[model samples]
Target: MRFSMHSTLFDPDALPFRRALIAGIACVAAVVAGAMLADQPYLIFAGLAGLVYVGTLTVNCRALAWLVIALQPAALIVPFFPGRPFWWELCALLAWPSLLAYGLVNRRKIEVVAFDRAERWALAALGGYVAVILGTMAYRGVGLRIFGGEQMGGRVYVQQLVLSILPVLMLLAGFSQKQLRMAMITGWLLSLTYIVSELTFARSQDMAPLLYFFELPVDGLNFSTGYDASGVRRFGSLAAVAGAGLSLLWVAAPLRELLGRWLLVTGPLMVALVGLGLGSGYRNVFASAICTLFFLAWVQRFWNPSRVISMVLVGAVMVGGLYFFAKELPLSVQRSVSFFPGIAISPIAKADAATTNSDRVEVLKLAIADSPKYWLFGRGFGMDRFDRLPVDDPNDSVSMLYSQGMFYNGFLGTLLKLGVFGLLCSLLFVWHVSKIALQLGLLVRRRTPSEWSFFDRVCLLLCAQWFAAVLLFYLTNGDVTWWMQSFGLLAGLLMACRRLKQDEGFVVDSDGVPKASVTA
Candidate 1:
């Protein structure tokens, strides 16, 4: 009898067995490879993990999303290989292709929604931003090699630009509100792990392995060694952003309801997470957390008489505590509060804060002074030999000022790299997304507490608050790439929410609450 490939291998009845056999074979191959690379244990384990991850993705493509979100914080801190693409960077590099393949295979099942007016504007702005990047590269004669270069060129800039927007994959993945909420929570918890580990290791002056493996070099300081005069450690990571934003959810009744009796622990948990985040000694994180909480309260309408009075009492008590214990507190805490006028803090904290402020001002001045030359078209991304001059060199300041400006100031940096046009594009992208958020906030306000599900409300609140905080960060501290990622996530959340609301088959009960819907 002639062997039929479809009947013998690809038949639906034989599919499960085939998958099992393939998995077994893969496991055996991994074992053999592990033996061969026993001396390089890290490489062997990484290979084995990759095999398992691929297998899981094949079984359920949705797992890819969970992994992406859950590993997001770790990605910032860990590297797949030394001094190479960070974990998050590698995820971005791999995610799009995997998503595309999944989409192509499941094309018939996937709904292709037309771009709405807001989405169109957002895309236009993004397109303009990309155009500016390319235009600058062409104008400056920079080669587009993304990896393995002593100097950062157009390729590095392009790579960062792509990675920043990769969170948009959440939109294409057709994630439900529940899935998004879970992923956000998972990411938040993972971020807390980082925060706790940092706090635990800081006292001993030993770096956590998670933070030590990559050692993201900023200026001359690594994450673990950066410290203040009072011996308070000061390390920065995107994890601080993620942890603080989600921790603010402790005040939400919807979240409380979802957690049931577990709600009792949320308040203290939030305090711990936020406190540890602040302990990282990044005032930007503290500022972002406060802004997020303010926005959350505003959106959630927590201005009721009792709530307002409670908030006032809490604020007063915090002020009193700080006033009494200012000198006794950790230097990081003192530094964080030093941004507020008349907040009593140690002299060391005050001096540190002033020094930081002075540095930022100098960088801003340099950026503004040089803005005229690259006003229309940017100097382009990457450093030249002159830009990389040693810090000790007397002549390096003026020569490297442009690159320093790009690194330190967000708005001015955009202008230097992509020019005025690119900055406008960036602003436009922010404007459109803010508009969408405003619209969503209005819609949420109109709904009763019962009408909205716990997951949907929390997801919307988290995204909105995080987006607002990122905007604040961009304006003050700079980090265009982080801003881009926040925008992408907010846009994706909005897209998913709109789809859920517009789906024809979705049902609502007499109380206006969604019934048996993905959102519900």
Candidate 2:
């Protein structure tokens, strides 16, 4: 192989990739899976990375994946404590510069025209975001309060912004095919492995595994009990399922036909879905599947009508078949079974057949009225509207709009962050990206060799995933683990994918790929 200087960067023999990641895994197993350590700093970083990419870690993504996996035990343990305050400081400070450096280096390797319009809009949009976020945070800082022993929480919040949001802007600066593939490979492999391992452990314990509507090896799960104090029937690992489920759906359209091409591709995922899907009891997962399937249908708009019709028909038949299955359960279990074929349209119910989302609706109403003269500009970035941020009558336009009105630069602040003309631009950018993924997904046949930008696919898929997740969160108000780590990860992945390459995927090879060597 001709050794271009850059070849070394991609070579598997050079960088200490495996060792670093193994060390990370060791940290996780020791810290998270086993016992509480005094506080390994790596555990915090690993958790943040895992949070940012619970779905994308694999040997190929980067050393970070191994680092995160090594730290997985800690990730499982993350909820036990408030993470130390300064975890993301490194990621925050390096955000934009690294993207710019890499983008500039690889600028000649890409077709920049795709993002020409998007870049122009985002640049203007970010200018506004800066003004609004800084201004709002500054203003709200006075009234914002942190929990006891958590006075440093604000710093953590801003640092998180850097780790997640800043990477987004940086990746957007270079929306290349190379980077996108990396993201996809990384997201798919790592997340899948984690799920498998977690499931294996859950089964070994004879515990109730919740994330799927399908089955896994749970020894002692009370299928008959709909609700338990521990929120029974909801898969335990699904705590991270939000990211995994959404990411999988992002690529669903493209992977849809590919699945049919070979049992190797289609059979495993289907079996996996059936085995894992019903166990979780997450309505968002259910809704994501429905919406993603529809989105893929829309993506395959030009495919043979017979194919599309067959899919729809098969889906209907399968769903209908499940209704009979639901009733076949012991009468006690059947009484608790109210998902899919039953409440397919609305996501308000749970495995126990009860509504669980009314609470988010109630909590979002706390912030009200267009108070600040700058209501149009919004309270600014990083403003926790949990204080008093509702901007309009509760009767008007759902909680997201209401919450955005009160805090997030309001409509004006939204404009400022996205620019007066750029909010739609950003929205369009998101929609446009999703559409591209759908198109590529539709065309991607198994083993046929997809020509779409690998990095772009990852970026686009992740964007779609986050778009769905954010949409669900905004629409229904799913809190708790929704934001804990996944939110930051999705945002960062979106940014990273936005700047991928043509053929080089995100996988870290057995070959040594160099570290982040570009001088920031």
Best-fitting candidate, measured by TM-score? 1
lDDT of each: 0.61, 0.41
Each candidate's TM vs. the true structure?
0.75, 0.52
Candidate 1: lDDT of 323?
78
| lDDT (10s digit) by residue, model 1, range 445-503 | 55665566665476457555756655675678565545455565556556555555545
Query: Could you tally the backbone clashes for each prediction?
Result: 1, 70
Q: Where in model 2 is the C-alpha error above 4 Å? A: 1-115, 142-156, 164-183, 192-231, 239-268, 271-275, 300-303, 327-353, 357-474, 477-520
Give model 1's clash tally. Answer: 1
Residue pairs with backbone overlap in model 1 = 75-88
lDDT of model number 1: 0.61
lDDT of 1 at 27: 87
Clashes of 2: 70
